[model samples]
Each structure stands twice: as C-alpha cells, then as structure tokens.
Target chain A: MRQINGQPVTTTNSQTRERILEAAEAVFGDNGYHDAIVDAIGRRTSLSKGGLYFHFPSKERLFFAVLDRLADRLVSKAEEAAAGDGPALDRAEQALRAVLTALSRKRRLARLLMVQGYSMGNQFERKRAEIFDRFAAVIEGRLREAVLNGEMVEADPALTARIWLGAVNELVIHWLHAGGPSPAQRADEVAVVLMGGVRAPMPVPMPAELAR
Target chain B: MRQINGQPVTTTNSQTRERILEAAEAVFGDNGYHDAIVDAIGRRTSLSKGGLYFHFPSKERLFFAVLDRLADRLVSKAEEAAAGDGPALDRAEQALRAVLTALSRKRRLARLLMVQGYSMGNQFERKRAEIFDRFAAVIEGRLREAVLNGEMVEADPALTARIWLGAVNELVIHWLHAGGPSPAQRADEVAVVLMGGVRAPMPVPMPAELAR
Candidate 1:
C-alpha cells in the first residue's frame, strides 16, 4: 500500500468511494432518485457533504453510479445462469429467469432501477437505455450462438434479444407499478412465448390457410 | 351552432382548440417538450399566449393533450386493423404492423410521442404508461378471444399483450435513438416471434431435456 501523509492513499480512497456507493444505493433506493438526498448519503457513510461531492459531483451522477453497480451484479447473475445449461435456448431462458427472479426478490432495487429514474429527467433515461443495452448484449450473444448452432431458425438474434429484454422490462415494470404476477412466476410462460419465436421451425403442418 | 353574440360559440372555440393542438404538436415534435416554447405554438396558431392558456393550462397539460390526441388517432388505426380480420392472431399481427408502420412513416410524431417526453419529468412517464395500457388493451382483447377459440394454447393474454407491446416499444425507440432497420421493415419478423408465443402448441417433440 502506497502511503501518503502516513495513510494508505489508493486503498483508502477506493474504500471510501465504495462505502459512499453502498450508502447511496440505500438512500436512493429508499427515497428514489429525486427524493434521495446527497446529505443523507453522507450521513450514512459518516462522511461530510464535501467528501461525498468529491467522489460524486451531483445527485444524478450518484444515482447513475448506483444503477451501474446494480446492473453489474444483475448482469453477472444472468451470465452465470446462461453459462452452464443443457441447450442454448434453455440457458437463455434461465438467464431471463435469473433476472426476473432477482428483481422480483428485490422490489426496492427493481423500483429504483426501473421506475424511480424517470423523475431524474432525460439524462437518467439515457442511463437507463445504456444499462438496457448491456443486458441486451448478454442475451444477444447467447441467442446468436443458438442461431449459429441451428437450434433456432429464421430469427434475427439481435432483434430477438431486444424483444426478450423488452418483454422482461415491461413485465417487471408492470409488476412494480401495478400488482400482478411477479416476473419470476411468469418467467417460464414468458420464456416459452419468446423462445417459441426463435426456436426451430415446427415440423408439424400448420392449418393450410393459417400457415404463412 | 349556438351563437355567442354574433359568433358561433362551440364551433369556433373547439376549432381554435384543435388549431392550437395541431401547432403545439408540431412545435413539440420539432423542438421537443423542453425546448418548445408556448409562444411558438401560439404563433403557429395565430393565438395569444392568453388564448392558448384559455384552452390548455400549461405546457405539460398541452403536451398530455397532444399525446392523447395522437394516442386517439393511433389507437383508432390499431383497432381498425384488428377488427374485421380472419384469425384473431392474424388481426393481432395486422394491428402490430399498423402501429410500427404508422410510427415508421411519421418519425416526427414518433419522436414526440415516444422519446421527447422523457425530459418533462415523472408526469410524462405516467402518461406514457397510460398510453401503453391503451395499446395493450387492444392487443389483449384479441388475444383473449383467440385463447377462448382454441387458436392459441396455455398463454396469459394480458401478459402476452405486454410482451408484444414491449417488443414494439423497444424496437421503435431503438429506431428513433440509434440508427437501425426501421420497425416497419422488421414488422414481419417481430410479429412472427411475438405471435408465435401465443400460437397453439405444435405436436412436435422437443429435445427430451427441454420438454419442460
């Protein structure tokens, strides 16, 4: 550890930043983006407001930072679920299930990540989009592999990933705003409907007229 | 037409309101909600700010009204496409196609309706949800009918509708924000993926491990 003025500098600095984020996450998660106070975060971290501002310049930046942390954890969970599985489609379904289940289990985090940021303005929306694209990339990678392996037919992996994430986003938001089946509970059904889209063409004949 | 003094009362009054909304839509569409000036709308409509206020209370109110009017037109278009159709699923596909195609053809309206309001704050988010519910209801209704008719099997119509709408929303936003294949061009691919979710299950074998 490099010492500056008889104190470990880099470790102490990063440690303080982490502590501030943990405290900020709770503050923002509890009060929402607009209501969450920077002072309150400082209080939770036992740091002065000036100290907090040194790490995060504004409430918006702090909120976005918290969201990035949350996205990181959630993406890791989804990747883990998708990494080891029977088939590419199955693993993809597990990845979707993992995300929904994680969010369903953490209502505050769900509200903060998905619903709360709307009040912060367009900047927050852009941040939301950036996070969504990250999730889409993970899902898209598996889907592209599935397509390549001939498990599915006639679907664009990139577009299919957006559709899947969009479906998950809508379900989760609906769950948060309006009382309904949790995303985890609906995950299987949603997966089937979505997966059926990209799954290989069915061998059975369609009703002649109904057939495309 | 009832006359107020010498002028037709409701006709002229309502006409002026419509004129203001038409101008407001263009202003909001071009400048977005935040950048758009009330005076600009007033200028386009040949009305005073006071005159515009007599119809709409604030820019937020005026924007919501514009969204409502746009929603009305778009919903009517979707409903028309869904009505008087062959299979419920086909009608549903047509409805989805109608929306994507309509939005694709009108990028300004799409930008205003879908993307611009993010800067306006939480109220705009609520309004977006309301409009989404209206679109979802139209889709859900047909899906429920299909479920009862045995054209589709083992699906929740309400949830399925959200999945479909969410996909469309994501695609449209992608097209608006980032350059991509227009939603209209991708409509067929999207529809098949979504509609396949609710379509009756085929009498085909899945890999034994994936049967679940």
Candidate 2:
C-alpha cells in the first residue's frame, strides 16, 4: 500500500475521499462555487484540513471533482437504460427517464452541474458543453437506430438529437423552477410532447366519394 | 433645453444617451459584468467619463439598463407577432420567429441577456426570470385562446408556455453554438418539431371499417 504521512494508504483513504466529495457536493450546491470552502467540506467529513487537501488540492479542483462524479453517474445510468432491449425510441425514453430520476434524487448536484457550473468560466463552459455533447451523441445513436428500425421518421439524427437534448434540458430546468411533477411524470410528459408534439390531431382523410 | 455642467443639453443629449447605451451593450456583452468598466464604454462612445456618468450612474444601473432595453425590444416584437390576426399556433410560431430574428440581429445582446445575465447573481437572475415570465405569459395567453378556439388541445397554458419558451431558448443557444442555419429556418424547424413532434405518423384508419 502507498504510504502518506507515515501511514499506509488503505480503503479508509478511499472512503474518506468519497465522504469529502459528498460533503463538497452539498456545500457547493448550497453556497455555490464562490462561497464554498475546503474547511466547510472538511467539517462535514471525518477528515481534517490535511486529509481533505490530500484528496483535493483546492476548491476549484474539488468542485470539478464533484461535477465529474455527478456527470459519470448520470452518463452511466443513461447508458444502461439506452442499452436495454426495446424499440429505439423506447430505449431513448428510458434513458431520459433514468437520467431525470437520478437528477431528481440529487437536485443539488443537478443545480451545480447544470446551472452554476456553466457560469464559472470558459473552462467550465467547455466541460458543460462536452457533457451535453455526450448526451447528444447517445441520443443520436439511438435515433439512428430508430430510423433504421422504422420506429421513427427519417431526419438528421444529429440535429434531431440535439433538439431533443435541448428539450430535455429545458424540461429539467422548468421542473427545478416550478417543483410540482415528479421526475417520472415529467419524463412521461416530456417524452409524449417531444415525440408527438403539441399540434392538434390531424383529421383522418374521408373516403374519396365522401370527399367529392 | 436642459443644461448640465454649464452646457446646453439638446437633442444631442438624447443621442449621447443612446450612444452610451450602444457602447455599454458591446462592452458588457464582450467583457461581462465584472470585467466591463465604464471607462471602456466611454472610450467607445467618444464621451468623457463625466459624460458617461451623466447618462448612467453606476455599472449595475448601466448593465440593467442594457438588459431592460433588450428585453423590452424582444417583448414588444413577440407581442406584435402574437397579436396578429392568425390562428394561435401560427401566431405563436410567428412570435417565436420574430424573437429569433431580433436575437440573431443582436447576438451580442443575446449572449449578455441569456448567458451572462443569468449568472450575475440573484438580482440579474430574478430579472432574467421575470423576462422569461413575460414571454411565457404572452405564449400562455395565445395558448388559452387556441384552446378556446379549438385550435389546440386543452392543457395548462402556463406550463405549456414555459416549456415552449424553454425549447426556444435551447434552440437559440444551440444556434449560437453551431452557427449554420438562419434563425428563420431554425425557427421553422423548431415550430414544426415542437408543434408536430418527432414521432412516426400514425396509420390512417380505413373508411370501410369505420362505416361498418
């Protein structure tokens, strides 16, 4: 095992890192990036300042770590759902629902990742865009499959995927703002609205004679 | 004519104010709230620091003035389109297109309002939300009229409006990022996708079966 400060590194070190991350998530989510401090995060964990600094050198690095962990979890859930056996659109819907469920469970993390993270600086903005692109790529792959399987209309998968992602983003932001519907309910609504659109039902064509 | 600092203020005074605002928009849009300074704005406007200060007292006030002007312009254009003599959905589409047109023309202002303004802290966030609410209110009014006129399915106008606004916001942001299609073209695509949805068309029922 690696030695640090004359103590052999063990699983406890990893656990301490995890605890610090969780505490950082809560603090950053609550106070935002500017007001968040390492000491506050350390207070929440069993670690002292030295232990916390051992894991994360600075507040910026700690914030990014929290965001990275959150993004990984979200992406993993989405990927799992997307990989399930089903119609492509159904899988896509499932993936979105999975992501939204995870987000609802971690609302603070969601705010930090989606809201505050974007405003930090150019570097953070690029990270945010890259994460969105990851989601879009996943969605695009599913959409391509849907088009091939005749489960959806043929369109530019890339553009359609991006538009879909945008809709989902907006829906999540709105859910955060209003706070009424459950993630599952909102997911259903979003899937329906995005898939079917809000247009009135088209009238069925009458028989030729009736039309004449 | 009003005189300040032993000089006569004429229509030139109004022109000077407009000049100051235009310069301020570019400055704030490019550098953001904190980095943007009144001196830079004065340099752009051919005005002395005293001249700029005469028109706007502080950076906060100047920033809000730019935002308020942009918001007013957008809201007015949207209102004009929404109040047109057309079906509610069509009017809504038109309103969205109008806003997009204005946004495309004033991309810097758009960035300032949508991206930077949201992160400037609680005051600007509230202002951004209020502006979004104004747009949503217009959309909701149109949606309510559509439901009454049998042009749309009955739904929560408020919620639907907010969702639609979110969709538009995402589309615009994506446009800013991707930079290919014209705003009008993108607006058309958005309207079609949003109103019609991405689902495959349902099979039309047979008339003979219906007659039976």
Q: Which candidate is the best by TM-score?
A: 1
Give all candidates' CA lDDT scores. Answer: 0.82, 0.72
Residue-wise lDDT of candidate 2 within B1-212, one digit each (tens)?
Answer: 76668887565767887888899999888766655778999899877898788888887888898888888988999999888678886787677778778877866767777666544443455566778888888888888887687676545566567667766676666666667875556665666666665223545566766665
TM-score of each: 0.83, 0.81
RMSD of 1: 6.7
lDDT of 2 at B138: 84
Count clashing residue pairs in model 1: 0
Model 1: per-residue Cα lDDT over B1-212, one tens digit each? 55656985564778888999899989988766766889999899867899899998888999999999999999999999999959897788889999999999888788777767655644566787888899999999888888888888778888889898878877887777777789999888887788776788655553443433
Candidate 2 residue-wise lDDT at A142? 85
User: Which candidate's lDDT is highest?
Assistant: 1
Tens digits of per-residue lDDT for model 2, A72-167: 888888899999778887787777778778877766767776676644533455667777778878877887888787776546666666667665
Candidate 1 chain A least-lDDT 10 residues: A203-212
Q: Write down the RMSD of all candidates, one decimal each.
A: 6.7, 5.0
The CA-based lDDT of model 1 is what?
A: 0.82
